[model samples]
Target: MVKKMMQRILPRAFLGKPSLLRRSATASQSTLAQTVQENEPVLPKMPPFDYTPPPYTGPSAEEILSKRQQFLSPAVFHFFKNPLNLVDGKMQYLFDENGKRYLDAFGGIATVCCGHCHPKVVDAIVNQTKRLQHSTILYLNPAIADFAEALASKFPGDLKVVFFTNSGTEANELALLMARLYTGCQDVISIRNGYHGNAAGTMGATAQSSYKFNVVQLLMPSIHLTFISSFACVSKTGVHHAQNPDQYRGIFGSDGSKYARDVDDIITYGTSGRVAAFIGEAIQGVGGIMELAPGYLPSVYNTIRKAGGVCIADEVQSGFARTGSHFWGFEAHGVVPDIVTMAKGIGNGIPLGAVVTTPEIAKVLAHRSYFNTFGGNPVCTAAGHAVLQVIEQESLQQNAFTVGSYLKQRLTSLKDKYEIIGDVRGRGLMLGVELVTDRQLKTPAKVETLHLVDQIKDFLVDVMDYTLSKM
Candidate 1:
């Protein structure tokens, strides 16, 4: 068995920096804003502490390689074939065992929303652990109840019921179960290139083949795949518009001619077997953070609902104000889903997931005996509460809109400058820069993209070491 090493611990900062908006605003404006702001005087501004207990930097890369390889655990996924011996992280930065910090552009696949190890989140976790940590699901926990209420209030309509889980996959899994039971249908529809999760039930809902191709032996039954159209919108004369107004155009009816008819044809062909549910990510996460075209989700949801199928929005990556303009990505499309699954940024860095649905849907899923040992335990729920509070108090959602827009603007400009950049898309901080060999052909520059990624990694690792040199 591979042995686990004692990973370096990074102490939580007790205080946070003053909100930048406060610093920038005039005294009068700041006073007025504070009065109206829901939670003024957010987290206390903390000074940066000496993260290093002591300094001892002697190993070079060659030495570290030999040492690390000797202690390497086979259990790790080895992302990008490089084992990132991460030691600590703060705000949008991660540090390796060697005390090198990285910009953390990926945000652990868009999980770290309020930055890493936020003071409020850390304080909640630490304080809650002192009072109560793990509480059985059989008992009602105040923290989880508060968290559920806060989360429910964020969404539209009656998405009040919540089922807590350990990860996005679990959330999606629960969502699948809920949808099936609610609709009383066996067949599930997933948009092509849409990723749900890796669980057996969710894997069935996932349409991406790359992640599920080898798992054929364990794949679930009654899974149906359909394309969300990627075709560009054109005028009657066939002159295409560079930007399509509708994001979900391709999935339900992307054929330029007889789009609805094409959808109807598929629905009719599949009708012999009733579709229990249709699940899709509000915004495709791994499938390039691709936003749905206008009228796409609404049309698809309507179609699925008309077919007596419940619509599920897998908001694992697109929920909780990450998309800038709206609180949820589905809201952007004006489509309301029967079920919504979420994780990642919900509890900041804490491991937490939730499946929110209408009472009508929840009542149906209640048939199966469901229990989680630690889902929505006091501490995790407290952390989630803290995260939501931070999001509101600091106006992080608005920040996501402003800063994310700025970042996107910069990235788009970069795309214009760099011939290798094919497409730059995403809302707020959840952006993607698709690198391509030829802009005209839109050929993905895989090699160049990898090289650029490496360059960025190196720069972050070497140049950003000072902040966490002793971690």
Candidate 2:
């Protein structure tokens, strides 16, 4: 059980960290350990914590799975073959039902900004809930107002107006709606393989086929919503998918201008001359943590604006200091977007999202009786404000920069030792290691990587079993 518990904690290996090769454990996680023979590098020792969660008193994982299979949506899924029942969390670790600790490098899908159940965030939520839980936007609430000002302060240029939502899907949905209305254009463009959200507008904007359903697009309402009923089944908006500026496998080989030309062609050939918006992430987190080819954003932004389209930066995955070098991923590209949509890390695991844009663009919503019913819940806003304060107070942005650089440097060195490592890219903490069956051909070794990683994880189980017995 102890050995299995340790395998549950395998964290940095997936990110290609060299912590496996004998080093001090970071606060977050331990280095990978295998049954090393003589002359092999030793597995780093885990640091001691003066903490352990109380015994769990709940249904077992199998029982929960049985209930879920019986009652829950079939679309929902779990990670490993047997789901891990995580019950408690600290800054960089999670506790399973049996109180086994696992280093949480995943950060709850990059949502836990200050770590799980961060004290400050918890305090803020509790205190705010004690005071006031929910109030419609028609009423005044200091939490929402204060948080809006603080979040708006993080932007540049005329992106002062803020609108809050419950998730990234809502944020992106609102942003796209604003773009179409403000620009009076029907065509939208998004980068291929980028994921924005799952709502009607955003699902159409989301370019990945795997995440997209055929009928959802057709059922989505048209851009001219006021004229049409909310349930009007207008064909999906004309969303042109631009070629992904993938530096590693792209035909242009890191030449972003070449990819930018594709968007120009898309505008000329795919739609009317004018477009509603051009949306993309600086770092494609869902698309293998690939950074857009150099100079891509500036060139694309210029072309989109020339076509009278607004440029939107979808910072859902790469925002809030996840990308170490900049506070917002788009900033690293040196472009200030006309609209920016963000979530995942804004409230340190709270269900909070926001869209920031110029006052002119934001005013489009005024044309309609637009509002999120549960968007600016006081408890959520208070928690979000506390998250912003914790990020600054802890200097987590700088920590991400410094630590991410170090990890990147170490990960880069692994390419020399392993022939399968095809490419190592991304800035700061948002990094990816692509495996290839044939390095020269760059054939994706998805199965091979998964099989090999599973072996490593299983080997870790053995190592933990050995170590725990000794202890």
Candidate 3:
């Protein structure tokens, strides 16, 4: 049913074409080269309206880079060979120090859902900041309470209780604890290539080796007293990873049921049969915008519940109408998770996140004193409330759906044209185009992918220029 609905919404041509990848390698290479050369640089045209940025009086990018190296952790990295020293943003466009506007395609790593520095959101933050800034959860603040009510209204089912945190990591950490406390089990299941957080508990749930560090050993032994880290690695012991049921490149094509069977097998063999929770991103964000196969979640959710576990939807990157089709990504799956963890767009780039669950599950937190110092800060909540309003008033969700679908269709055309463009997948604005050398083997064309990304950057810059010239 879900597949049929998707077919109605998206072009039928966008569906799986398994044999396309099996085309002759020589013809593929020739077509790829011809397509790459023929594709001209196209820039996003600027809107035909009057707008100008305030003068930038800050230090130069070079100076900032020097200061960053000296003051910030080396772990902090920047994209591009020459990193963008972005100084200003308005809606969907970002401006560098010289006021050169560029379309923000990634949307601040998919955090700025309603656009950067949205007036309504900024006004709310400014007004709230002027009224009251700092107050802990101990005090009764209307901002937090109001925002909580507003956020809870967005979800279906009994996911009414809201717990605020400073980041997605904190939200996931809290959710993990709630699941364990409710189920009285320590084992948790997450999908390979899924990322939850960087904190000790969430770090364990995260399956990607790229994000995991040696620091897990230092934090796990002391912080997570209930779980042991000696199960080979922090992620391996208490947490189990099911194969990411990738549609384009998986053992089971688009049959989600086939991949979900692995989760059942993992529970029977990998764990002690009973578990606390099954946590996953509705659409894997940093893991290359991979969407779980259709019917995967419904099957897995039931499987986890039968194993005495709760289902957690990590919406840090996929929530808040970003997917276009649904207000929440999990809604597209036709299953409601026991717990929903959100960040990124929830605060519109502000450091805010939350875990929404049922009252019965929330009672576990009440069993012991739990607090987050700056979780529901008044200003942040006000901004969050404003973000919700902006999304509704501006009809941004509809915009995401329309624009994202059009973009995906165009990307699909590119995939059909160029063999290097192996796959283009995702929903709404949260989309990805995977590049591969040999489509048959599904080999990652790393160097070519980087080049294509550079070309995209150049094209966006050109579009910005074109828009400015017309203005």
lDDT by residue (1-471, candidate 3, tens digit) is 211222221222222332233224455545534433343233245555356789999999889999999999999988776778999898778889998777788887789998888889999999999999987889999999999999999999899999999999999999998998788767788999999988888888898899897664213243565554333222235788899889998889888998999899988987767788999998999899999999999999999999889999999999999999999999999999999999999989999999999999999988788988999999999989999999999998998898788778766765554466688999998999887877789999787666556655655655543433442
Work out the TM-score per prediction. Answer: 0.75, 0.86, 0.88
- TM-score order, best first, reads 3, 2, 1
Candidate 1: segments with Cα more than 4 A from true spot: 1-76, 79-83, 213-263, 461-471
lDDT of each: 0.65, 0.78, 0.81
Residue 94 Cα positional deviation in candidate 2, in Å, after optimal superposition = 0.5
Top-scoring candidate (TM-score): 3
List the candidate 3 regions with Cα displacement exceeding 4 Å. Answer: 1-49, 215-236, 464-471
What C-alpha lDDT does candidate 2 achieve relative to the native structure? 0.78
Residue 458 of candidate 2: its Cα lDDT?
38
State the weakest 10-residue window (summed lDDT) of model 3: 1-10
What RMSD value applies to candidate 2?
A: 7.1
Which predicted model would earn the best lDDT? 3
Per-residue accuracy of model 2 over 194-224 as CA lDDT, tens digit each: 9888877788888888888876461334445
